[model samples]
Target: MLYRKKRYRINDYVFIGDNCHIGNNAFISSSVKIWNNKRIENNDKITQCNL
Candidate 1:
């Protein structure tokens, strides 16, 4: 997993798999599971699983 800056926010129960790239200003809500090889762009707001 690669995180750009400390400006990202990951809430409770957030599961991010391997090889994931969390960009700057990204927000991941609760109970959100991101699979492997996923790319979360800058300023992304993920409230749920997109897969």
Candidate 2:
């Protein structure tokens, strides 16, 4: 797992798999799961799982 910046917010029940990259100002909502080898860009807002 790699984080591009320190500024980010991850809500409750968030699952981030292996080899995932979360960029700056990223916001992950509740119950959102990010699968493996995924890349979330800067200022991203994730509200659901990425399969």
Report the lDDT tens digits of candidate 2 across residue range 1-51. 985447889998999999999888989998888999999998999887654
Worst 10 residues of 1 by lDDT: 3-12
Error of 1 at 30 (Å): 0.3
Off by over 4 Å in 1: 1-4
Which clashing pairs does model 2 show? none
1-51: candidate 1 lDDT, tens digit per residue? 995455899998888899999988999998899999999998999997553
lDDT of each: 0.87, 0.87
Candidate 2 wrongly placed segments (more than 4 Å): 1-5
Question: Per-candidate TM vs. native?
Answer: 0.83, 0.82
